[model samples]
Structure formats: structure tokens, C-alpha cells
Target: MTRNSLAARALPPAVLVQIPATSKANAHIDPGSGSFFVQMSLVGLLYAGVAIKPYWRRTKAFLTGRRSTPEADDESSDS
Candidate 1:
């Protein structure tokens, strides 16, 4: 058999892609819904964590040896 024929046999069959559900024009938003509240809470927490990550990293660096502490003057005064 040829190399091209061997390579073609090794490949798997093509898969069918599934389409997701689309929102209809008549969809309504209920304020007392549980799913909406859960989704909003998760999104809010995700955004908050992403926004504060840089500040958290800076604070962690100060706690570790990676960055200098602002209390250096206090330590010097104590000694």
C-alpha cells in the first residue's frame, strides 16, 4: 500500500457539531428566579476576584520575600 493510503486509513471519521439553544423573542426575565440570581452572583464574584487579583498579588509579595514591606521604618525605630 502507498503512504497516502495508509495515512487516510489512520484518520477517524468526521463528527457532527451540535448547535446550542437560541433565546426566543418572547423570552421574559423574572426577578424572583433562582437561576438568574445564581448566574448573576457567580458572574459578580468572578469579576470581583479578577479585578482584585493584582492587588492581592502585591499584598502577597509584601508578605513573602518578593517585595519590600512598608513597616521597615517601624522595625528600625524598635532597634
Candidate 2:
């Protein structure tokens, strides 16, 4: 008769109904496995690009004589 007991009695059923498998479905295309590989490759490429971006920028700046820091080589004639 308590609120807690009434709440406990309002629980839904736990049995889950599943759809039966079909025989005519294509067995060659495993979408889950393909999607997993694709996701992993994309994540790897994303991390690689992120890891190399700073190095690429620094190399580019150094090669082009573009000082990246405040105490870097002075290019102006303000002696």
C-alpha cells in the first residue's frame, strides 16, 4: 500500500520479442564488419592528420623563414 511498493509494482515486462531470421537475405554483405573497418581507418587517418599538422606547419614556417616565436630572428632593420 506504500508509494515505494506501488512504484515497484508498475515495472514493465522484461521479455523481449525478437524478429525471426530470413533465408533469402544476402549473406555476403556484412555491414557491421565493413562499417567497423571503415570507422577504424577513418579514426586512424584523423589522428595521423592531427599529429602531423603541427610538424608540417613548423617545417613550413622554418623553411619559408617565417619566425614563429617572439625571440626568433629579427627581419626588420630596427636596430
Worst 10 residues of 2 by lDDT: 70-79
For candidate 2, what is the lDDT? 0.45
Q: What tens-digit string does per-residue lDDT give for candidate 2 at 1-79?
A: 2343233234322211123546766668766978866765654444444444445656868899985653231222112
Indicate the TM-score of model 2: 0.42
Candidate 1 stretches greater than 4 Å from native: 1-32, 67-79
Error of 1 at 63 (Å): 1.3
Q: Show pairs that collide, candidate 2.
A: none
lDDT of 2 at 44: 45
Stretches > 4 Å off in candidate 2: 1-32, 69-79
Model 1, 1-79: lDDT tens digits are 2343233233422211123447745658655568856765654444444444445656777788586344431121101
TM-score of each: 0.41, 0.42
lDDT of candidate 2 at residue 75, scale 0 to 100 = 23
